[model samples]
Target chain A: MTPAEDYELPAGPGRNDNWQGVTPRQAFMRGMAVALTVPGIILFASAAGYGALARDAGFSLGNSVFMMGVFFALPAQVVLLDQIARGGSLMAGTLAVTLTGMRLLPMSVLLMPLLKGKRATRWRYLVAGHFIAVTAWMEGWRRLPLVPSELRMDHFIGIGTGLVLATLAGTWAGFELAGSVPHVVEAVLLLLTPIYFLLSLIASASGEADRLAIVLGGFLGPPLYVAFPGFDLLLAGIIGGSIARFVVRSRGTG
Target chain B: MTSSLHEVTQAAGAASGTLPTGLTLALILTVISLATHEPWRWLGLILGRNIDVDSELFRWVRAVSTALVAALVTRLVVFPAGALGGVPLLVRVLAMLCGLGVYLLFGRRISFGVVTAAVVLVAGQSIMGP
Candidate 1:
């Protein structure tokens, strides 16, 4: 088995006891601290950019900030804003945003198992589902394998909550700073979000298949977007992913 | 739904002289997104309980999502939007390289790369005066 495969196996007796002294709350707090390092900064930058964009588009500050909380998916939120700014119909805006968010469905499904706990309530699952954006999902997937199952939920929640709160704060900051900040600085701040997501996604990629998918998608997206415009995202994902999967499986590397 | 939101935004615009387009629609979209996400997990619970977490299908889903995100990121970088469109292409590509370099050199920590990219962009733009 690959090193990555070995990493996913549950720790044996003494290994699991490494966290013996750490309380669940402590574990949760530690997770939050780690989250604030990378994911929080990314989310903050992205949300700040989104806020600035919304402000430029004439969205009320309240609405902009509220959107951060309501539609935690940054891409979908941006799509909603873009559609609205273009004077698209409400249904068109809603459908576009919803379709953009369809990617989150699989993420939510993948996360559900990692979050299993003896005492986990249905409500916890429901609420946690809302927070399962790319950041939370990627972070949780990386960290949860070694975490004791009991503390998994706490860790996930801690990271997720930190990201959510950071997004909120960033949105407000971006909105308020849009006017006073130099255009260069504002643009750089906006760039941070996508850069962070791309790097994290690539850096934490599991194996060759994922790497291949990233390459294919990166190359294919621009031309596809120019050709199909609205459908580029979905088509590139499905096509690139399938091609990557086939390559990996055919090579017998997976 | 479209007509109602149009009327609402139009009425609000007429009163305030500013478009409050899709406020209600945004709310509706959020509700729909949240509501739609739940059923997938429930389906997973019913069907995926016995299946391996990293099953082939799960891998495919992850791959597809990752590809989608990659595509979106690429689009944002290449085509850009709004103010970003004004920045020179070379600076953007160079900033991305600087960030990627930092990401690899700094034990693959994400913050280092992300911060490096942002700093590079700001510094590059300031120096170039564009």
Candidate 2:
């Protein structure tokens, strides 16, 4: 086996409940299936909310859809949308989006290594990488480890494609249905993504170290925001994770 | 982009004066927009090229990512932005806590917990009013 394929997640011996015998076809289908579930519904709803908001902000349908297609990160899009809606210049919108997008750096860094397989080329990553937004990333984070090396790319592509389609449809609906859907309902839809992502993170944590990091990060996240506004996520990760690693090592538990 | 060559040239002259036409401008903007978020992925791929998945560094990366995501989710619930901002802080926090409580108490069913939280949030909002 090639070195990249030779590597495996450190699962305990006799861990049998993995995605064994999962062919690339099955993986892709399963990925699509995942996107049709609750998480996917939440994502679609939130995208609808974004679509309504952008429309109300006087963004053209083309501009809103194009933004969804490219700048898949919602937080950056939200900042830019809000900024522009308030009469901020493009440069100012750029600044806001850029600052909020810093969290994606770590996200990309973390997923890049995990997604690289023996046959996976840079082009595949370049195309699929754009779909590494919050919902897709969160779902991928929970599910990717179960995927085999060869099927990983296809599986992720399936999920990303389904999600993109869902979001695009949502944008159209919200843009068109902006008036009919109660403003309150659209706002409520926006709350689901964060809550869902949080629960998934807790659910999918693999071990003690991950759990510890989650605890520390959760405890420190709000307080740290006061100390450093935009950089809190990065700092919480570095400090909370480093401390978790050190603690786990010294205790001989990891 | 579909504009004629003459119009493209004129626009390019008006805008960049030296840079290529709309295509180059579009490419630059795409890169800048992606740069806000994608560098870490590229950097991670480069650095992780040689790193063992089972090593301490891998564990650290996983931990860091988990921490980062956890923090982000927490921040969203606590210091929410956009729509969630309309709801009172107390309601949001209580709803999150309720969800966390259910996730822990009920066989780790994330869906159940989230449903509970959503119901709580909506109930809290309506009862309390956004």
In candidate 1, what are the lDDT values of residues A100-194, reduced to their tens digit?
45556555656777888864677767667667776777767777777888888777777778788889999999888876887787678667656
Residues A24-105, candidate 2, lDDT per residue (tens digit)?
A: 7777776777668766776676677667766655566777776777777665665555444433345645654554454444
- Candidate 2 chain A TM-score vs. reference chain A: 0.66
TM-score of chain B of each: 0.69, 0.60
Which parts of model 1 are misplaced by more than 4 Å? A1-38, A83-114, A138-155, B1-22, B35-48, B51-58
Q: lDDT for every model? A: 0.69, 0.65
Backbone clash pairs for candidate 2 read A108-B41
Model 1, B1-130: lDDT tens digits are: 1122224345545654555535764565467556543354444434434645466886787677667778877776776655565567777878888998987776676767888988888777877754
Off by over 4 Å in 2: A1-34, A49-64, A71-156, A171-183, B1-29, B36-50
**Which candidate has the top score in TM-score?**
1
